[model samples]
Target chain A: MKSKTLVIAVREYLAAVKTKGFLVGLILMPLLMGGGVLVQSFTKGLEDPTPRTIAVLDRTPGETLWAALDTAAVKQNSGTQVLSVPKPRYTLKHIETPTDAAGLDKTRLDLSDRVRRGEVTAVVEIGPNALKPRPTTTPGTEPSEDTAEDSVYFSTNRPALLEVRDFVSRTIQTPVLAARLGQSRETIEAVSKSSRDVLASRGLARKTDTGVSFEPRSNEAATLLLPVAMVVVMLMVVLVGASPLTTNIIEEKQLRIAEVLVGSVTPFTLMLGKLLGGVATSLTLGAIYLGGAAVAARQLEVLDMLSVGLVIWFIVFTIVASMMYGALFVVAGAAATNVKEAQALMTPMMLVVVMPMFLIGPLMNEPHGTIGLAGTFFPLTAPLVTMMRLTTPPPISWWQPVAALLSSGLMTVALVWLAGRVFRAGFLLVGRPAKFRELIGWILKG
Target chain B: MDDAIAIEGVRKVFGDFVAVENLSLRVPAGKLCGFIGPNGSGKTTTLRLIMRIYAPDAGTVRVLGDSRHGPADDRVGYLPEERMLYKSMRVGEVLTYLSRLKGYKPNRIEIDQWLERLALPGVARRRVQTLSKGQTQKIQLIAVLIAKPKLVLLDEPFSGLDPVNSNVMRDAILELKNNGTTVLFSTHDMASAEELCDRIVMIYKGNKVMDGTINEIRAGHNTDTLRVRLANLASNFDNLPGVACAIAEGDHHELQLTPTADAQAILRELQQRGPVELFEIARPSLHDLFVRTVHEGAA
Candidate 1:
């Protein structure tokens, strides 16, 4: 950089970094994110843990089903105590059922009242032939309500009690299956245990000189979280770093300081200086956040999850995205005569910066899919989408990252050059802000 | 002496509006030149062209003997008509930053000295926004001159300044001239232009209507106008011989002479009419010249 540009950059960087707003933002972002998690955990610990009482009405003409359900609930409740936060316990209360249809309707009405009054958590009604095998229906055909004898109805006022519903549904399946097969409980248990198979996913094993070594079991959740986390962090850095350039430039122009500065240095130099300054500020923010994350990950023994190669890639993308967005923001500032106009011009650019976030899920699902490849090649989205692809399973080929870097780097240069032209033409422009068409004209003509 | 600034056949237009047309001018080194014109008459545009802030559509602008097209070299400084500075920065920091851009490493001492010279002592540490309007103007002037350029261009340097601050600014510009620095400034204040400028350049409607030293410009115009004050308050010179026109000016009357009228005869006629307390033939003031030039050009 030229001495003049460097001087301007130093001033720009200090001007932004020294502000109280910057400090507040720097501290507030992490606090908000961490505080959200802390608040959620604190609220969870305060949940009502009283065992939910479920009323059961069995019309299958047998008392064995209720007894079996009671035993299963006891076993489940015992097993939950070993965990850090015990699961919700369920207590079954058997209700007598009548043979007549009118009596059955009355019993259901009483149960509905009890559920609504919060006297019981839910009501489970077993159909008269719940243990019987379900009739097979042809494809695309449905069984009529009157004929669906194997159905069980579970009703509750609270739709969000999914865990309670799932527990009851799982616990009653064995008892019903044994009754329908007319087999003893032990025999059914043995058969069920014999036929079950558990599937576990693991990373590919590599062959060593002496023997083949197996890789550790894959944590699917962590695998998905890493790339998403990287992309989120990158997006935050770019937004924080580049968004301020527009306001700063607009302020300088509105204050009429731009003309004085341009009198000393060319408009291009002034713009480039500010761009570098913004990039530097963003990198500092990223380092602070990522460094804290690294320390925490190390303490949790998950540091290996963030490989050195991935960290380097994060830095590369952050710089590229910052430059591209920063230059465009500078142009927006130069073309606008006020903050409102600057914001109006910056909306589209902001959308482009954040558009990759919406595509992250698809890009992670298929790293080499059409959308993923398009995002990787399109300069604007490449930094974010490519970071997501890097962390997802079925890692992309080595050349993909290299190609993305090249394409994005080239685009950044082109944008900076274009921004310089617009800045030169618009820096001294005073009065109403330029229209989009006029801005394009400046870019083309300058 | 070499010309500090030289523009040859410069033409600049914005859209369909021609801001400057076929203009050429030169200012000798170490001379103080006043650029005078009506608003929107292209004085600012010409100055920007010399500073390379605006490139001419068709022209060559050479400043400090260098003609390369880019930002003006470090030897030239400019203070725009609009007074502005970074309101958030201290006065000293802004000065240092601007000075560095010109390749001058200004120290705190140098900034303080410039501030002191502009009658702005102890303001180096204060943010520009905190200063009064006059103080801000003085700081802006110091920002331009802190680098000690060979040539300085000021646009409306006295626009918003109080009389005291204007004197301070005027003294600074005179000091620059005495130190062999070329100064070119534009303003509507004709008295200041006449008192301070060694030569004046007047442009009207994008054309140079007059350009010369003060004496030369006055010598070029007709100097047959006479000022007369009489003891009789009802006296008038409308019918006096060889007087083409006459107008009352407070207690005095100004008479315009026909080309062939004699100054001695006009004086004698004024004395014979009444007790002439004062009588003299005088040249037109700079204010009169400016008004006449603009009016005639408009016509």
Candidate 2:
């Protein structure tokens, strides 16, 4: 026969998982996560294969800007060599037109129809003084700057069209400024490259028996995205699992059912059972979210960015984190008289579980810095902060994670002991709800 | 025979308030004992102390020969006053879980038998929240008794129950006693206590005021009061000899006799003055004794 604690744990597990809410969470979690990847890929593939034919009506030195736009497009396409297919190519067409307002209006009307019919993606009209610098003093007047009047007109409301417009403006503006400088094209290019200061970003290099060797810098997006995802999943599981534990205990207390239960089983056994149930709840939700994330990463071809070591750490951290938070939830639940009372009592605990969220960005930026190490040592934030550090380029020392795991495990045991004392006294308490001081007194007395 | 439950000098205090003060009561093995008291009379507190839900300030409680302080023994069963089960769980599941907690492996056949016995045969698969209030109470009762424990402590089992359900519970308690299970129940419902209890223990102001068989306690009061209901009686009913005082009741008169007066002698004199419809020597009831005992203790 199973021990009473295991029986209670199994009962709590089955009771929660069989509910309709669990079923909804089970189905919706994966769909919501998987849909994000599918939508991004779908939009990327939807770009029209036929090169978008853009009509350019230039008044002064339009040929130079058109050449620059093609060059930028080639550079961007070449960077897509990692993918199986090439990016959408742009073809710029020069159209002849008078530089007067009426001529511009007529040309626009002619091109707008082609754009509407999908024959052209956009029309760019360069102003009459496009390549000339504005007069510093407007012919015997106060000095003022002149803004460029270049315009891009497109018919479609698609997002890719917006991207194309941005590319065209950037391509033209670079050369226009170069023309204004009155320098040769080669001199202008050399000056533009050397004038701007760009910071070099590199991963940490550690000393080894073979001398210094640098680890490759992690992908910036993956480094931030993975930890943020893990933090979010942790927060969600804690909230979902812990709140129900509080409500369940309060229900038993208010209804006086706990009095009957404790008569059959010890308060410690009952509390341990509840903590185990909480672990099961959190693990179920963790599996769905983590599994969805893994599938999404594979679909996006970024699975390699997530290592086997990081996955192992994530699993260990989730279990330890769940136990710590789960015990607190049970303690709060046992100490409360009602649902409202339970929520009010759990505020401090909830804050502890979510404090790591605010530190996620800093931890990702400096995975081995003081802030990260501090959070890793704080028992409440250790699991998530350490997991975040593991996802970074630099590997954390083995002792840090091992110590964090042990700390969390010890904390969980202490909380279970604390909750058991509270349950013994508070479960049968009548009249007003006991305050935090009284609960502390119970713990001390126990 | 070993007493099923024995509490000695059990005292419990919460904060500055004394909930149970030097209270001790016992139930002999295989007897249906009623714990009688008004609200806040420490009945529930004393039961909690016995079940080890709360440690007594200065006392010892033994149940089924185990007195060590800890969780309740598996041989004991307790039915708390308020009824509660997991609202989302099926009736059978709740029963199974509770029985398993008491170290019993309750199979489907056993669960169905208890369900049928409680007249809740078709509700084994129904969620507890869906059941009526009376049905829910019955389910809770089954959870308490499913272990077939040696000692059963039920607190206010019949409170809020309708007549039919109350009878069902009353019968079940009697059946449990017949099966050699020692039963201790606390309630303010006097008539149920009078009807079902083989022995009655009454507490007041956190102390044991009266404890004995119902007849023994009643006989101990020895009020020597007689109740006579007359269809046709003389106007001077108060003038009868040996009647110290005459208190008029509805179509009857309660007479307190002198210490040396005989009840039969009063009946003989009353027969000459009026037609005697009914005549009985009054025995004090548990309710009457409880009120007088609490009031006397207060004074």
Candidate 3:
């Protein structure tokens, strides 16, 4: 036969999971987190896509100009390729103009008409001496003048015009340099690769028994955001999981169900069942988020950098924290007559639960800081703050986590004991919620 | 085990307020006992002590052979004054869940049968919040009795029920008694107690005022009042011999005679004066005795 506590736990779990709020929270929380990650990744390396059409009057007197335009398009498209963003393909229109100064000026004057007619997003004019080196310049010497030589640009869209100007500049410069150096493409690539110095940056890794494993360092701060965010998520689950206990207890009291329940089971049994149910709820939510995070981490190829031990600690800490907070809420609920009174009684406990969220930054920055140690050793904040510290770069002593876990467990048990006493005393009470003095009186009398 | 419950000098106090004081009562096994008292008269406090919802500060209480406090027995079932079950849970689910907490297996068939018996078969899958007041009361009553407990304690069970629903609840209590379950319900409604209780216990200001069978309590009170109905006559019947006072009661007149007065003489004189349609000496009712006893105890 199952114990009565298990029955109550199962009933409480079923009651909560059957609600529409549960289903919505279960599905939407992960989707929201995934959406955040996707938004960051998409916005990282690419600018917003705006359509552009370029009219290039390349007066450089050769059919090879088409080849230069193709190369520049490929180079411009390659900028977005590394980030996996879709390239905003631009239409390249070649303008037929005489190589004389008068004809060039006439074409430049017509650029605004073409833009007004919507024939192109922008017009770029190239002079006949656009790629011709001046007699004062030699190979390997810095070109004092730009190759596009006083090119007149016209556009209605500013962003599109900037992109077109960049494409046109690169289209003229690469070919002019190659012609001036008289070098083949293979030789230029080889020389550039040999002379380039790539400076790679990495974050300091936690020193394990074996060796240090460094995490890839990027200018993006999101790499450090994941662990701290996990702490916040776990804290959020703890708070969410424990909220129902207060309302449920006070509701049962106001509805008089607690009278019937107390007649059939011990107050301790009822409290134990409720605490177990809360832990189960928190764990269920944690599992959904953890699974979603795992899928996301794997997709982002950061799965290897994630610590399995930290996740395990997250599960343990969430259960302990939820039980501790759930017990306190139950006690507060039993002391009150209604939801409003219950919330009033729970104000102090709510503050305690919120303390760790504020300390997240300090703990993430210095896992062994004084604030981190205080949070880890203090029974109220230990489970959350300690779990956060374990995921940060600075590795804590093994004894710290073990000590935090043991202390949190003891504190949870003590709180449950106190809750049972409060419940027995106030389950049948009505009219007004107990004052702090009365609650203390109950505990001391017990 | 002749008595399902036995309390002796049970005293409970909240802060400085004595909710129940030196209150002792007993309910015979397989008997329906009405715990009668007016509002705020220690009725709820005493019932809670019986169910172990509140531990007595100064005495002993034994229910179903258990003396330990705090819901230590599975043989006791309680229906509190407030009838709030899980409002969102299905009717069957709530019943089954409550029964399981009482250490019984979930019985769908039994639950469905109960729903049908209560004329609520269609509500088996409905939420309790959607039910009418009477319907919710019936379901809560069922939850109390579903565990087949030996001792059932109901507080203010008939407070807000209509005549029809009140009859249903009255019959349900009697049915539990027939099943050999000890049923003790607290109520301020005296008529129901007079009609339904085999034994009644009355308390006032946390003090026991009366306890015994309803007939025994009524017989103990002075029964000198006479109820008479007659045709039109002189309105000076108040001046009749041996009649101390006459008060009109609906279609009849209740004449309270002095202790030294002769009731036979008064009836004869009234008959000689006018045509008397009805006249009878009335016994003291539970309501009358309750009012008299509580007043006397207060004095």
Candidate 4:
């Protein structure tokens, strides 16, 4: 029986690892996630030496705010090339006319041809009260009850257009503040230049205790994300990774292999073998995914924050969650009549496993607070919650996870026993799930 | 006794509906025993009970001297009526896995040898879903036989097989019996049952209706089948003195003899009209016995 179980486990592990779906997930998850981070770094890697083509639609007369706007973007260490033309090469361009009515008529005629035909980026109308918010309340009276914006209009579905609008608004708003100083253009320009330098110089001075903050973790810093990621992996291992394993068992039962195996071995053996096999299969897939993440992260710089020890946690939690869900899934898989029922069974179980993630705020607010401490202690929810706490800077005591590990070990045993009971009788069940007495009688004996 | 299988006074009731009631029977080692009955006559239910899939409500079962409910090391094999093999698994892998579960590591050479022996060598590496029903049944049979258990119980092993495959199965089963393995098969095909079974036990509606060797059963029932051909087309044997009834085929008439009379007298009279083409005496077959038994049970 022991040999058979081990054989079942090994066979299951190898078979799952060799499957196309598992292999794809194993190769693709790390590549996709790590690739996302890599893609970010690659996109971020492009140097900003070249000036940007800054297309502006300033409707204010004689470029009233252009000089001030150019200096503000320079303070942020980026360059801009100003473009103001009779007709810009984008949609939503303004066609200046002699009068407001004339302008409206011309815009009506040209808006379709220009904006719809992509002649300008946007129309910035500098009409009467164009850049001003008209006062809604008098100084001596109670405030009016309108809780809405003054006005701005643009075509729907162009979110990037807001960047252009807000830039112009900021460029114009700064001069309104500058008007009170009653300074000449040259004086305002000098002061703004001095202020921009002061801000840029201070930005470089903002790094405090950088070397010292990471120095304490220098020896074990390689693996800080390991503990946290392991917990996440633990949940994912059971929730997402066990899909095919459960499907394998369910398909067999549907195919009637349960009875065939029962004829060869004891029902108890079959139950245990299948559960262990599922666990082995799930863990094996997890290892491949973890390994891929490690390799892909090594090639790119960002993923190096996670350590080999994190991979170890992945193995441990994976084993724990695997057995836990493996036992659980065997019963569910046995009860389920088809793939849809099995999926329906798993969705709730998955939500239960991931519910702690939704409450991460409570747990992270105080890593050792009553709620966080209890979350760390509770076996079912601890793997994710405690590890979530560990990801931050509290330097959680080692005793916490040791205690959790013990409780989970004991919980796994209990769950396996209960699941074994369910698995043993559930395999023989046909039609719908039975009532209590009938279910119990199968376990007891006819 | 070291019987290959013995089910005694076994009763199984699902809720208020009894599936098997006080069923008792035995099969000696090294025999091909046919288990025959109608659809709801408890054949599959009895097989399930024998496999301990559903434990009997009362009484006990012993297979080859070991209790049926004992651990799996007991030398026994089962092929269920409903087929099940891993669809995605390579044939060799699945067979090896199942064989390992049955307490043996199947060698590829031996597995291939068996597959070739069963004329399924082409499917050894292919997935099970790609195989035809006959091919899959062949694989299933090989899987059950790979361990070479002392006893093998098959439920409708020939249900969906075409005639050729059915013949192959019959031959394999006879070979197993010759190899000293006790075989019990439940089937609805009475012709196969008649040709294959060494002994039989018939049940209906959760009760054993008849139990015996084929000859004993034929002798007990009023279903004697005669091999009598008419001497002339003008002759009518229905009104003959000793003939109870007669059924005519293309060139022959089957006559049933009256209990108190001799069939030789009728044969002599039929010989007078013209020379008889053929005449022979044979007992009624299991099909005839089955029909008579069912009619008697209803009566």
Best-fitting candidate, scored by TM-score: 1
Residue A208, model 3: lDDT of 75
- What lDDT does each candidate get? 0.85, 0.79, 0.80, 0.69
Flag regions of model 3 displaced more than 4 Å: A37-199, A202-223, A304-308, A393-395, B233-235, B297-299
* Model with the higher TM-score, candidate 1 or 4: 1
Q: Tens-digit lDDT track for model 4 on A1-446?
A: 78877877777767776777766665555564457878887655243323222333334455444455556545533323223212111122224434465766566455544545555444443333233434566778986542212222334223455555565566655463354355555676677778785542111123356542222233243344444455555565555445565577677777888788877766667767666766776676677666765675566554635555545655676677667666667656666667777777778766766777766666545657888778778887766666666655546788887787777778878777776666666776655644556546644652
lDDT of 2 by residue, A393-428 (tens): 667889999988888778877877887788777776
Most DockQ-accurate candidate: 4
TM-score of chain B of each: 0.97, 0.93, 0.95, 0.91
Cα lDDT tens digits, model 2, B139-257, are 88898898888889999999889999999999999999999999999998999999999999988879898899988998899776788888775545667778899888787778877
Model 1 agreement with the true structure over B1-299: per-residue lDDT tens digits: 89999989999998899999999999999999999999999998998888888898998989999888885578889898985888899999999988888889889988888887787888889998899999998888888888989999999999998999999999999999999999999999999999999999999888888899999999999986888889996887766878999878887888888999887877787788889887878899888899988888878
**Model 1: colliding residue pairs:** none
What TM-score does each of the candidates earn? Answer: 0.85, 0.78, 0.76, 0.79
lDDT of 4 by residue, B50-130 (tens): 676666779887767766564564377889988778888889988998888788887989999988888887677899889
User: Each model's DockQ?
Assistant: 0.59, 0.60, 0.58, 0.64
Off by over 4 Å in 4: A38-156, A160-162, A180-232, A239-241, A292-312, A360-371, A425-446, B68-70, B120-132, B162-164, B223-225, B241-244, B256-281
Candidate 4 RMSD to the correct structure: 6.2
Model 2: residues with Cα > 4 Å off, grouped in runs: A24-176, A183-224, A293-312, B233-236, B239-251, B257-269
* Global lDDT of model 1: 0.85
What is candidate 3's lDDT per residue for B87-136, written digit by digit as tens? Answer: 88889888988888788775788998888887788788998889999999
User: lDDT score, residue A192, model 2?
Assistant: 74
TM-score (C-alpha) between model 1 and the true structure: 0.85
